[model samples]
Target: MATTGESTDTAARTGEQYLAGLSVGEREIWLKGEKVTSPLDSPELRSAALSMARVFDLQHEHADEMLAPSPDDGRLVNVTHLIPRSREDLERRRRAIELTAALSGGMMGRTPDYLNVTFACFSGRSDVWARRGNEEGAANIVAYQKLMRDGDLSTTHALMNPQVDRTKPEAEQMMGEVSLHKVGENDDSIILRGARMLATLAPFADDLLVYPGSDIRPQDGRYALAFAIPIATPGLRFICRDSFSKQRNTFDYPLSSRFDEMDCVVIFDDVEVPRERLFLDGDTVGYSEVITDTGWRGHIMHQAFTRAYVKLAFAFGLGHMIAEVTAVNRFDHVQEKIGQIWNMMELTRAAIVAAEAGSFEDAGGVWYPDERPFVALRGEMPKWIPRANELLQLIGGGGFMATPSKADIEGPLGPEIEKYFQSAGADATRRIRLFRLAWDYLGSDLGGRGELYERFYLSDSYRMTALAYTIADKAFPASLVEQFLED
Candidate 1:
């Protein structure tokens, strides 16, 4: 309903205006062999851009209800920009992520300010080191939060160190594998070298949220740094990878037609980080606490669980549509399959409920799930959800894979597909439509992408769901352990 003025400078841009506002250089992409100057024109990049732009649009169109107040500036901040000030606030933030996931069918279309909120909380709470008369880190925190509020910016985080020879010390092992330590003084700024492990749309973000996830001894102070930088800062080039939406067939597959997330490996080649932007530099204790903090874990847990919950909703919706077209709703086995779907949905829902209901710690206005329970759920999903999808496969039989391609439906072969693909009262035309819908979830590359998206989130999708029980729990009664051991 609300319109964005293309040239008008306001809190944010409209979906269209936001795209228009981006510097052309920011979007110049090299994928595979071709040079793509405008990612918006490239099929692979369009979906991701569209999805992100939608967030800005929401800020303008739904400003009164969905947006939150900025404490730093007292202005309205979009859901992504709103700081999480309580446990309930964290849940609300998680719900917002879920809404976007459902809109994009869990394809990883990110909402900005995601990592910023967590770090903002960190800036306020963490102060393990002192540099100047003023603990500059804490002061930078306030400034950055205000910066985020003023710019109405979005940020992307790169934390996980890439896999390397674990036998080596982290100082050596994580060197080339992730955002490594760079040179600089405790002066006006710091200079960073090396690169990050996994970059996610950093090229397009307004700023970068870089921090270490590993435990750090005081000796590892060089690696225990936290900082933010504008994407266009000198020497900060985000070397992106080839888009996964590589399929050449653009007319047929809609899901693959546009990927929702464009994750890149950001290359910080001798990048300069201004001092004010540096939240934690050369402070290992502070850096470790910020990450291992319940604030960080709670935000991530809530985001992952909510994303999964929405994913199940999308999966089961397609499953129901498939059953209807085939008229298998009458079959007892089909009914059982539907019941199975409901169960998977419940699993995700229960985890969310347990998290909110069992919230253990509250800080910076955000509530974190108990480490034990959250970790348990984190380690449990991969094993169980796959089996659920397999059951959907069993009931649908070859129906999932048997679906005709969208191209066939529109081409001369369309008639044949329509006649044969239709199920029960529906003709091949109707059935193929349903089948194509199902294909997006269970058959095509999109389906695989969905699974890939989830696989990327859970600790290990191949591991047992029961592994959750091990990591959770603060204290164990020795008597109970002794009785079990003796028995």
Candidate 2:
């Protein structure tokens, strides 16, 4: 293991440094109708914040695996920020991603590394932002990438405009005016007002990123914008959903207590983004091309799909454990249920390997994973994850509810509990602990949110599937069919 400060000549910030950064406390993060003055003091927010800090520390402790030298300077950076130029570099990044994912059993989706990878892609394809009179935007991207890399900043992004009404065009809706759109600009800064949703990990992050969440219609050009700003910027506020981290008992609400990354709707009240920070400005066509043309799609999906694989593998392991403890591994039906989860987990793993093996250099000389595999994986995950949860529920059955609380196991009922709760494979205490964990993972609010996040994380899975079909190369397959018919 590397010494505390020796991870690199310029050390990645430690867990303590990460926590201290959050303590400066200018960011407006509201939870349960009150502004969180100190994230470390809030019972609901502290564990998740600490969880992120731990990952930051992990970067230091496992620096050999996660940290790399910055291209511009010798300062060590996270592999997520490393601009991959070869398959070897990509494989190195994959290992780091796997380590981070395995840390939380892939429960924390918006780990800082997620955006670390994002900014890396932005830097890798800075030229894409240089067209159509936006040379400054390209420069801002590369500069910002280095800024965050050197700081080892934890960042979250709010991409989706609030879902107020789907039937009407955004400009036509009553609440549409409040959706995040550029209102005006001064010489040094662009002013924005309105709101964006699903900013996961907003409170804990050092910065918040805003970009086009969907297609920008030509008429909605005023809404086409992208920028990164401090989460504490004046006129910025994060209104969070009620926390799933309310339960503090690590044993009773294991997953919820530790990994409840909060989601929020970010309201911007004429927030000013300085010229140097704005990456896209009211250019609808350019905004639409950023992800696909700049290598962000493939890179982001590479990180996301790695997490998906880890999450599925975690689910499978949890299911297997439940079966083993209850001795349900003996039954054919139970075995079949277990096999279903295994199948999905294996497929996800296979996709990651396939994508990496077929990695290619884009037109800009940046290497990208074969995004094709993850496109399929992303669409199928929504279906597979929910069903995996169901199988775990089926395997555990009423045992999830029958388990005793942590207090009950330790109180006057201890003797009676031990007598009754023991399984063939585990003692009563062990049995109760396992069931409580399963409940926390499958039945709690966090569990429900996890399911929803997977469904919509990369936008609607249904649309993703349609997009895969639309963009796929059908010519070769069609030609083969025609050849057979002619023969």
Candidate 3:
């Protein structure tokens, strides 16, 4: 592993390079009640590992769009690591994000670019992490960003505290160490114990980024912490959910096989965080300000919303294909269902465009998309994908259930499948393949997880709506209504 200020080859990494890095260290990944020695060694995780490698390969294949010239050296790096200084830079970054998202049809949400954009924003506003006299921590952020950028490392973040009891704050819970908190400090590092929830991509990621998830009260300073560390660090373990990638056949489980991108509960049992790797400490006020103070919300949403737009577009195309193959598009209700998905795609695209058009450079000289549209979109976004999935179910109707498995189609039932499954627009083979994809995306376990992830990935939708209304500037619009009433 590279030290705090270590340098590496400046060129962007390839898929092979990424796969080789996973074997350099041992990560404690627990899946299906067993300790997985490595991602490549586990059947459930290998598909996602290869899928991510393909993403890296695609970046190189389309280097003109995804790779950018590093600011420090003239070497090429992923565009997600590029700090945007102008709208043109933001557009270039958007192209990279959109291309990556399209590769998985937006099924893999935590692709490496997600955190790459995050650290770029954090490093650009390195001053904010220095608040409360933590200059050393701020410098660490800059060095870490360059380290990851130069190496093209993949990182996963765990921000949400474990849900031991929802009624009380973490500090007030019956268990004192229920959530990840500081226990002691040595001359050179801090000792941490407890765990964080929902670290997607933990098994395959090179590093883990931990930060304050919710607002920490001043009295709960012990619970406030932030840092970056390798996933293989001693005393760190990741317990993942059941594997959704149960089937290896692409025809049977198209999305799940390649895009599970597993989520896990990250446990840090007496883990030691080196001083240089610690970016935020016991400063509660500073911890509360990290996301906004660094303009990370707007910057990350650039990648998120772009992925969302691609997902909705995929949903739209699938819905249309299903309707066309089954001859349902001739009906009014089917057309309306298809149009609903199109509307969602257009709305997301409009939000992305509006946010970029309203982009502004912050006081730290870092550019960010306008967050107002993103905030509004978040309130509506939690429902868009699920609703699209529901519409797909309605559009496909009985066809989803009647579809034959890849094996059944190639077995003794082959002649029956061809004779009975033919549709108005497609032959039996094409129709089965198309409908199977729809089912994999709409009815499978991976599809359910995708819906749940969208609903809560950015936090509770109701709370987001409340916060949006609370922080929104409404005086001018209210005044306009008041003047009309007076007249």
Q: For every model shown, what is its TM-score relative to the native structure?
A: 0.83, 0.97, 0.97
Q: Give residue 128's error in model 2 in angstroms.
A: 0.8
lDDT of 3 at 192: 96
Local error of candidate 3 at residue 29 (angstroms): 0.5
Single out the weakest 10-residue window by summed lDDT for candidate 3.
1-10
Error of 2 at 454 (Å): 1.0
Q: Candidate 2 vs candidate 3: which has greater lDDT?
A: 3
For all candidates in order, the CA lDDT equals 0.62, 0.86, 0.89
lDDT of 3 by residue, 373-405 (tens): 988888888988999999999999988888788
* Better lDDT candidate (1, 2): 2
Residue-level lDDT of model 2, residues 1-487, one tens digit each, is 3345453466478899989999775888898889986678788899999999899899888888988776665677788887899999889998999899998898899999899888888888888888899999989989998889888898999987777887766676674696788889899999999888679999889999877667767788878888899988999999989989955578788889899889999999999999999999889899888966888878888898889889888888888888899899999999999999999989988988898899999998899899888888777888888898999999998888878888888899999999999998899888888888877777889988998888888888799889889878899989988987883
At residue 7, give the lDDT of candidate 2.
39
Candidate 1 accuracy as TM-score: 0.83
Stretches of candidate 2 above 4 Å error? 1-8, 484-487
Q: How many collisions per candidate?
A: 11, 0, 0
Give the candidate number with the greatest lDDT.
3
**Residue pairs in clash, model 3:** none
Identify the runs in model 3 with alpha carbons over 4 angstroms from their true place: 1-10, 484-487
